[model samples]
Target: MNKKFDILAIGAHPDDVELGCGGTLAKLISEGKTCAILDLTRGELGTRGTDQTRKEEATDAAKILGIAERENLGLKDGFLVNSEEYQLEIVRMIRKYRPEIVLANAIDDRHPDHAKAAKLVSDSCFLAGLRKIETSMDGINQEVWRPKQIFHYIQWKNIVPEFVIDISEYLDVKLKACAAYKTQFYDPDSKEPVTPIATKDFFESLTYRAQDLGRLSGVAYAEGFTSEKLVAMKNFDGIVL
Candidate 1:
């Protein structure tokens, strides 16, 4: 199998990626960049929908965004920890994908698992580059691979983005992808018990949050992210919005 991807995004759960970088991923895919999602958990503890339903929803959302691949790690929801076992799992994936850039869950968030998963992925990225910490898959020896950069997407909390991407052209497409998870998001007809994120306000907030970020960046719509290291651009011409 080819061990390469333009981008690999890791989130604590299925919908987290859709809520955070759906527009960015859509734009990249439209530009012919290969992208994939690696959800740490199946979101089994969510208030709405079973793990099976969420898997289907995530599949539909990935198709809507035209992503090249989507997969879940099957970690226990709400119980993700920064441990050796988890780090090894992530390291294996990092080597498997060999992405140039990785987008991970926020460093801090309302969901505790998000932060834990972020640290695990970040650590695994560094470990993946070390020839000593070996990791493999499918009985085959995997090459040590590390992404050039890792950017953490902002969600649930406003941590002041290190940078925001102008995704104005793909904002509507992002909403379409998010709405693909009908079993998890706002669905008035669904009889499932509502969670904090299942309310109508949650859906509206997705739009307003992007709008707010866009207003600051002087774009119609944008997505925010915080990076541990500042971005080094080869040329500044026309890149900043």
Candidate 2:
């Protein structure tokens, strides 16, 4: 996967991206743009499933999304920290993929790791551009690289978005990708331990939230994001009617 990516979505856990911005990703891929996902952790601490189970689920989700690549860093779950070690690990991926846009975890969320991972990725994207800060992978030196934009997807919180992507057509595809994580989401028959996300209500919120965002933004369904820097549209032609 040496080819540069159009977008790279980073998450605190295996299923975070699926829950957050899967619709936008699906829409982008359908438009012929290349995308990738980087899970900062294997979601090892989730009550409903094992790390291995989550990994398999992540694979299924990635396949459903039709992303170019899905990689996990195997970082400690539930204990994410904004430190040099973590930042450098993410820096390597940023330089390796050289994506144009980066979608990251929410700036603030119900889980502390979400916010921490958000900051870690934000800083790494900046550090990856520093020519002096050296990093090597597979015994080869990596060239400095940085994404043109960083956007944090809305998670458990409704954090007012800087913008929204009209994903009305791809909402079904996103739901399908999320359903791939069987053990993590709503399942009436399975006897998995009830986690905050495993509830039926949580499953339904996925649709309502997107619908609400779309309603406010004059679309049928949409995914909202907060941009670190102002995004400029080349012209009025890009605006949704």
Candidate 3:
């Protein structure tokens, strides 16, 4: 697609974007912002689902979130490394999308891949802006483009947030999108191997965590993000009381 996006959310695995920022994404799309999701890997190493299953679930979740586009980089799961090769691949996507903001994996999380992907995406966002660092797509040289801001969505850890977006009305949308990953979540009927996220408690944490953040922020529900740079607002009027 040739259309520029307002935001691009990149995740290490298929469900990362959905669990971390689905509510914010739904809210953004409802407000008419163009958004896309890029999965760094298909989550092949996960206990419960096959790569193909995750891919299908991701597609369904993308549709539920009203994403403009979704693409996978085919990176190796569990063995994710912040290498130049991976960074270049991400740089290519950054130049292609030309997003104003980038939502990436948490800086550090319970999953090792999460931290690695965080660095990979953050570095690629910088490298993508350097005209000398060349990349091409579809046999055409891509333009050098950089996002104005990069934010890290909270994942498995209860890390403090730099900011929280009010997603009171969009929380249901987020939960439903996450539920699309039936094979990966708390599906009691599935005879698949149990994992940390396959438990009922894990499913409940998705809602309670958002609720706790909302309680702290005085919103009914919200998604939290951490940024490398300070977030500045044009005026205090935009701040939720």
Candidate 4:
């Protein structure tokens, strides 16, 4: 696989990435870095959207974020497990994309699938680097590949972030990307069953949450994430002043 990505954002569902780290992704893509999205499921179990609609919505969201590529692993929604079968599927994607950085789901969240997918993706990243764990795609053998680092995005739970990325200029883009999932989020006109995220307040919370994180970190808006391992900085040159 010659298509290498600078970052691969993995989520349990279609909208999880948009909710958790859309602005951060948009910022990276704007800077000319290639990014991709790996959705573990089609979100078929979501209350308001069908699998077909979520797929369409995901496509629109990917376009809004200027993603280099997007893929769905077709895993069963709401039944995710950290099994070898699942890990091998993820390993194939990791080897295919060869991302240097990976953005994963929160360590713990309101949705059980979020936490399940987090561990699944994290373990797969390590497994992908092992030469013995072989994976193939489209009849081609894959080389071992591992991300240099992983950062878990904040989700439904307010688990404190280890670091925050300033996204003051990209918050609107983030909101837009999340909004692309019309059925999954707020819409007064929709007659479909109202879900937790479909409320007007939940829609507003997106902005406020980013603003709150930004306030704490001294930026207008930001996205928070926790590193899986301790990160070392070579110098203070890249530190935000």
- In candidate 2, what are the lDDT values of residues 1-241, reduced to their tens digit? 3359999999999989999999999999999999999999989989998999999999999999999899999999999998999999999999889999999999999999999999999999999999999998888899999899999999999899999999999999999999999999999998878888989999999999999999999999999999998889889997888
TM-score of each: 0.97, 0.98, 0.98, 0.98
Tens-digit per-residue lDDT, 1-241, candidate 1? 5479999999999989889999999999998999999999999998888899999989999999998888899998999988899889999999999999999999999999988888889999999899999767988888999899999998888889988888999999899999988888888998989888889999999899999999998988899998878788878885763
Write down the RMSD of all candidates, one decimal each: 1.0, 0.9, 0.9, 0.8
Which stretch of 10 consecutive residues in model 1 shows the poorest summed lDDT?
A: 232-241
The digit string of per-residue lDDT tens for model 3 on 1-241 reads 3458999999999999999999999999999999999999989988988999999999999999999999999999999998999999999999888999999999989999999999999999999999999889888888899999999999999999989999999999999999999999998798988888999999899999999999999999989999989888888996899
Alpha-carbon RMSD, candidate 3: 0.9
lDDT (Cα atoms) of all candidates against the true structure: 0.91, 0.94, 0.94, 0.94
Quote model 4's TM-score.
0.98
lDDT of 4 by residue, 50-144 (tens): 99999999999999999989999999999999999999999999999999999999999999999999999999999999999877899899999
Instruction: State the RMSD for candidate 2.
Output: 0.9
Count of backbone clashes for each model? 0, 0, 0, 0
Q: After superposition, which runs of candidate 3 have C-alpha atoms over 4 Å from their true positions?
A: none
Which runs of model 2 end up more than 4 angstroms from their true locations? none
Which pairs clash (backbone N, Cα, C closer than 3 Å) in model 1?
none
lDDT of 3: 0.94
Off by over 4 Å in 1: none
Worst 10 residues of 2 by lDDT: 1-10
- TM-score head-to-head 1 vs 3, winner: 3
Error of 2 at 57 (Å): 0.5
